[model samples]
Target chain A: MTPIDEDPPPPSPAESLRMIAEQREAAERQLSPDPLVYHGPWGVAWLVGFGVMFLRHGPGGTVLVAMPAWLPLAVLFTLLIGAAIVSGVLAGRTSRHVRGRSSVQGAMYGFSWFVSFAGMGLTLQRFDDGLSPPNVGLLWATVAVGLTGALHMAGGAVWQDRLLFGLGVWLTLVNVVGTALGPGWHSLVISLAGGAVMLLLGLVLRRRPAGRPNE
Target chain B: MSELDPVIHAQARLRVVAALSALPEGDQLAFPRLQEILGMTAGNLSVHLRKLEDAGYVEVTKTFSGRTPTTLVCLSRRGRLAFEEYTAAVRALLPPPST
Candidate 1:
């Protein structure tokens, strides 16, 4: 193994004892939480919040005359429904590595979300006449939201939690596809499909890991 | 190989060897658990573990009982000697307690 970033200089024995006490105190705080219930609901709440925000705006102004005013509602529903499905995945599979690894994985997921959004942004500029300055601004905000999802996922991964990783990937795909379709048919289909997939994945993640200790 | 003396030799391996030497037989600690107990991170714990294994002062066992892999550290006969020597050195370093 590559040698660790140089070994820390040894503290005086008394100092070492103090440090040990501090670390133990911190770890105790982490392990003391009701590991299953606490983190599971925490993950669920985040996804629910994401879903609520997507649906609250009640869709954007209609682009096609033939399309009903309610078309935006359909789009919003797809996104929110997808959010609900994936939140289940996040809560179920993310418990083991929650302490140290989740933070790093969450950040990485955020970066991936941005990269995917940037790709979608350039794609949107190519096709539609309706792509106004404000619309472009919305896309940027979507990109930021995607980044938040990614960070949460990455953080979960670092902590050795699959739920976080699954959610991160799910959100990244949603943003990428949502952007590529330019707020119309493509985004709707992708969101619905991804949400369905999350529903399935949550079932698998929630099961007990073979031979692992109980939480 | 680096030249080594019996006395200065065991100084570097002191803390970890001390910790493992104190454990009851067959109970092994995972890296993070050791880190918490010893107030060290995985990196620090692994480093000392490697050194102790090299000197035959401790035996390192890597195995997975489940999804998470485990690193088991145990004292070897030779390690038990080095630890005894180390304890002697530490005692030697200290002045006797006043009666």
Candidate 2:
């Protein structure tokens, strides 16, 4: 233990350099973002929202549940909006105290999410009267999920996280296959492949030690 | 010979400066957080931080968080330049790389 006033004897030249490197690395690790914080909320949102949608219908236009079709859509949108809000506020806190390149990048990425979703929502609404219920449903589901997958891929590339990029690719492929399979199955694929996989990843990876110790 | 800045040459203060320098310009860390990282007692860290503050090498801000008192520390602009100079001086002590 070092006394308050006593300094350690002068370190050797190599030792001094090593010490500096060690301290910088430790501090950076402690300050890095947490994966769980990023993944958990979205995982839950997709899983529950899509899972409900899957249960509301069955194969070959059979109605499995008596509830209105709007119920599942409402649940999915509500959960998705909730997930977006929670993630934004929590993630924003990390960059709140500092202003620099990383901070600017975070802000811009967040704005992109807002802008892309808003634009998609507006374009879809323009077709409200023209498109039939089934066609519009297909459009909304495919467009939203597709945009999410594309954005995830973009984010993964920007952050250089291979797992995230892979997940985006996985989501995109499953989304396409699910759309082709049709009639209640699209939601099934999304719930299981997209939502469940994310939840599993988010939960399992959460157990891995975070770079920073909790304060 | 390039001389080390005496204010930063001390091991504890050198470590504190090194850790703080990792933060981006104008960013700050709370006192408890710094102490936790360094594994130092509050008294030891406060003394070293005080010395760095006196030398115009670090900025220390004391304020209340809700009801509790909090100390926030950041390396000043002078401190960053001093650390850069110090690292360069330390490098000067080493022999040049062989081809």
Per lDDT, the best of the predicted structures is 2
Q: Residue-wise lDDT of candidate 2 within B1-99, one digit each (tens)?
A: 756788877788889999888876656777887887788999999989998999999998887768988777889999999999989988888878899
In candidate 2, position A207 carries an lDDT of: 71
Candidate 1 chain A: 10-residue stretch with minimal lDDT: A206-215
Task: Show the lowest summed lDDT stretch of 10 residues, model 2 chain A.
Answer: A206-215
Give the 10-residue window scoring lowest on summed lDDT in candidate 1 chain B: B2-11
- Interface root-mean-square deviation for each candidate? 10.8, 6.5
Residue runs of model 2 more than 4 Å from their true location after superposition: A1-30, A211-215, B1-99
Predict model 2's lDDT versus the native.
0.78
Q: State the lDDT of candidate 2 residue by residue for A1-215, as single tens digits.
A: 23235686346767778888888877765665556667777887788887787777655656777789789889988988888887887767665444445566668878898999999988998887897665667678888889888988887776666677888899999989989987478878888888888888877766765433211
lDDT of every predicted structure (CA atoms) = 0.48, 0.78
